[model samples]
Target: MFGPQVFLRLFVRINQDLWPWQVLAVVAAIGIPVLLFRQKRFERRLAVGLMAVAWAVSGYGFLVGYFGPINWPAVWFGWAFVAQGVLLAAAMFSGGVREAALPSGRFVALWLIVVCGLPWLAVAESGQWQALALFGIAPGTTAAAGALIVAVITGPWRWLYLPLLVLWSLFSAAMFWVLQAWWLLVAPMATLFLVGAGSWLSPRTAQSPD
Candidate 1:
């Protein structure tokens, strides 16, 4: 369960006046690929659209306590948007929609270690155990669950991608909540870049044909 302090910190950070420039930058960064990438129109559209929706909801929640009255629903919807975005990106990169091969086992392993394992370790080392448990542990657990589900639905190698995408989305969300800095936009921005690049490099044609 999330702690009150964490929510308090997030509320304080987000409740500050919104910066129009920062919002524009985030939208632009997310929009570029949808405009440029024609090969994977469906995937790009889905990813960009979900990201836009999540960003708008988060921004609105920050501006007005739309959630303050019925907070759980807002939080649930917010995360649902993020989860959908993550899954859409995962499917795009993991050959669920198009012919995009999953990242290599070694690459996927390294990605998970850095994105998920390292963050958890860093939080624990810093003696922020509650934060670690809430943000690091819980997210890691859900990521593992997502990975398991992906593996069952796809394959073991495909499962590895979920942790990467989930961790990326979680870090992006945290940055937006804690810093209120536009630079935090880099997390998911980089994630989209990686997914597109990985798909290009390792085309899904390599997978065994059914």
Candidate 2:
């Protein structure tokens, strides 16, 4: 009876020269968000499938010793934001789909400002303000926060969240060189796909008694 941790450790050892945490970080990033929001069984399965793919990719990277430690958590979360984008986009375009009410423009703007601003504050408090001067704040944190704010204000335009999730994933990948943030590459992609598929296949509208 082997567990994920046991397998993960084994993979790490085999990879030797490479950092295995990156792989784990990415998988967890994607897996956690999907698990958080997946309301349908089929969608859960799809998300799981995507995670499996991510794991396999990480394993391959590990075996080849092509690993490094970066801000993988930030990267993964960034992809989660992309998933949110996709969901929002879908909600906007799909005809049969019931669009959730958009958030007030003021609310969205205010939330976006907060989302973008808080990371700077966090870094400043940590004496990492100089780091921000160089790399800026982590985009994943800001994007994810903004998307969640939007979702909350909009009252669950679940379908519109996908693009944000994709954006998160892409951002994470782009930052791979900066922090070797591999999690950004894998996690959000898997989770967002799961959430998206679930949202897509769900009944168009909830029914009410006549």
lDDT of 1 by residue, 1-210 (tens): 343345334433432333333354345333433432345556544543433344344434431243334345445544654554455455555555433334345334434433444334323333443232121112222222232223222344444444555554565456445544333344454454445444444433346657
Error of 1 at 19 (Å): 38
Kindly give the stretch of ten consecutive residues in candidate 2 with the minimal lDDT sum: 129-138
RMSD of every prediction? 14.5, 15.1
How close is every model to the real structure, measured as TM-score?
Answer: 0.32, 0.30
Top candidate, metric TM-score: 1
lDDT of 2: 0.37
lDDT of 2 by residue, 110-130 (tens): 333433443343233334333
Clashes of 1: 1
* Cα-based RMSD of candidate 2: 15.1
Kindly provide the TM-score of model 2 when superposed on the true structure, using C-alpha atoms. Answer: 0.30
Task: Give the clashing residue pairs of candidate 1, or none.
Answer: 101-204
lDDT of 1 at 183: 34
